[model samples]
Target chain A: MAELSVRHLLGIKDLTREDIELIFETADHFKEVINRPIKKVPSLRDITVANIFFENSTRTRLSFELAEKRLSADVVNFSAGQSSVKKGETLLDTVNNILSMKVDMVVMRHSSVGAPHFLSRHIKANIVNAGDGTHEHPTQALLDSFSIRERLGQVEGKKVCIFGDILHSRVALSNIFALQKQGAEVMVCGPATLLPKYIGELGVKVETDVRKALQWCDVANVLRIQLERQGGDIAYFPSLREYSQEFGIDKALLDSLDKEIVVMHPGPINRGVELASDVADSEQAIILDQVQNGVAVRMAVLYLLAQKG
Target chain B: MQQQVILGKELLQVTLRRLCQEILENHGDFSNSVLIGLQPRGIYLAKRIQQILKEDLGKDIPLGELDITFHRDDFRRRGTPLRANATNVPFLVEGKKVVLVDDVLFTGRSVRAALDAMTAFGRPEKVELLALIDRCYTRELPIEADYVGKEINSMISQKVNVQWEGVDGGEEDKVWLVLSENG
Candidate 1:
């Protein structure tokens, strides 16, 4: 049996090249399993999984829960709103209490960076980070890389330019780790204000021009500006209009390129902001495929970890 | 490290022919029967048997592949994740008899997992097991193959290696009982 080196999937930074490959290979099998008439597999029937989402999310929460159910695992869902989290319990207290009920695995989404990593040290069960603050989103990066591989046949020797907010985007940081590990040259294309300090030390080129980045790469993973992550003191972008005009990915902007690059986004897509609706709905876009592939990617993660215990 | 050949190509061909004849006798036309290949290794034997049954009886029966990686009882006992084969059962098993095929029948745990996995498709009228090699007295579960090619004496420390032409990309079919690394 081929498996991950790490027990918990905390972030992409902790994953090696082979770990990512094993995940993609496993995801390839689960992708086929999900399309069959009986979409469920009786693999994790006895093992119970708990999905603890301290943050509000529509797609990630639903995707993790569905992946668990599809694997035939007994699932218990906990959100901050309905759970004892409203009663002012600590993260460890809420999770440890859930663990006391004999849960084998946890799928966690939190607003704090390193929350899953923090909980992993004190807990005994397996932990999968759905999305942890602006730190990293490992599964999203996996699916994005998987989608790019599906389009280009390989991730190595290909150019992947990530457009939009980088400082406040977990998707960007995780993808840079993932794509670079798979031998793809990565570039963060956005306003300099959104770009993090010493991002070049991560071995990625910082590009301010979106057109050249699109023209030079085979795929562009455009990220949203993160309206909530933005606040006073230091503005990431001067305004949404100026940012869209310069860094936004639209069909018209993409049409001017010599070749069409694959468009991708971690959704709750702001239609007219980071990417135009037409581009998101275009033939070149693989947003829906990414969503579809996310379930399989996560199923692979859970199924692999379930085998370890 | 030494191995002994139990059955070669000559006996393998004869065994498949006999299994086909036995199935032909049980269900004359195979009208309401579906053949399922237990995945990872069983699909080769299933495919060959399906081929022989088609050529002999002039029947095209439903053959599906079922992977029992998830249904295994010892998932947590291992340190690594199980590599899963594809489960490609296309037709329903609601009102049909399922003939489960595999390469070897050992402790019968895989067969048990296969039985559990069959429930997801639909309930079958009845299910039967067919294995090319059945190790006697190794029943961890109360399961037995209805049509077995050959019964061999073996120990838990030994492994049964079944090499099929279509499955293993070998020149011919053969079954060998070899000592495990620990043994």
Candidate 2:
């Protein structure tokens, strides 16, 4: 089981529990490499990776870039906003053009669902989906689970609740699938309008009440409200103040709990909205750790995928 | 398959003691030298060397474990991907003498990778190799051991196996040469 079960990491659903564990094991090694003084490896020196992003991203883009650089892989960054995508260039044409330059792997983030899957069908190079539309962000889910396992020892048989906007968050969906596969009890907590009707069929417990959801789980992974992704005209809730009063996680709320539930967030956090500023900077929050683990996890993903013959 | 014992428990004990004596002769007091074990199998022999050295010196010496999975040249050549182990080089190796310990020295590729992996810690003033079993006439590189316990000529199809006590239910430590019929 040294190699990953799958060739590409398009989504969490495509990964088995063993594959996830293997990634974690590899990530454990990369984590040590990154913490060292040199903080680099020559594993991918002969390989070239193209990071094609069709959507705007800050942390994920930088994290993937850092991961590639740390592995000593030659990197070419392509952002849709600055590319010929503005001139109506098709996805296939853009990728094929990159492949013509002898790229070995493509790490893409597109606004359309299954964009990487679509590319995999036509392209010869390996594809890693950073995020596709509101679909799956596999690396985020992996780093989150890795952070949880780092904090609490193991993910098996643990109660984990994903709190906040569920209908539009790829993090929530991937977390549910990854946690469930790893034998953790999952619960999704959010406003009813934000939680999709099909969520229950995924075998995760659904709760609209935030306090009860927090009380019932060992970990609370809070997500930001995807206001941009949400149709601008439609409002999921009445206002920000009311939503914060009902859903925002503050230090006082955490202090009220009988047990300390490890809090996590996939940044950039909407400060004072889903999570309070105090809680975000609190020692209990693993937000910074998740960000740091993102690079190691992505390095593990790239290093493993490049090994596919 | 055929198996032949190269070194039994008593011979191993004497070899380890002799290796420690040579180490103490070269690195007096061990204040400026560090022992580094290559990961997976080398750590066992390294621990034995460290223990024997400590018994003679009356103090503990710095030891570290290095994993060269990422530094290997055969990243995508093998059928199975390489898995990494933990590398706990807690102290800096800057301007320090490093002694790399391993259970067996076959093709010198792993030693080459270990040299590359050591750069992350810092530059070493000098480097030396220590192997309990040196598989003769099989080195793919121009690498030689400074402290050698025993040397044996083996075929490509024959594998050198080192079994430590309390590991894999073995009652005592032994080195065996395993010969397969195909080769």
Per-residue lDDT of A99-195 in model 2, one digit per residue for the tens?
9999999999999989999999999898999999889999999999999999999999999999999988888988998999999999999999999
In the predicted model 2, the residue pairs found to clash are none
Candidate closest to the true structure, highest DockQ: 2
Scored against the true structure, residue A178 in model 2 reaches a CA lDDT of 93
- C-alpha lDDT of all candidate models, in order: 0.89, 0.93
Candidate 1, overall lDDT? 0.89
Model 2 vs. true fold: TM: 0.98
Question: How much of the real interface does each model capture, measured as fnat?
Answer: 0.76, 0.97
Recovered share of real interface contacts in candidate 1: 0.76
What is the fnat of candidate 2? 0.97
Residues B112-149, model 1: lDDT tens digits: 99998888788999998999999998789899999999
lDDT of 1 by residue, A143-256 (tens): 999999988899999999898888888999999999999999999988888889899999999888888888888889999778886767767777888877887788998899
DockQ of 2: 0.86
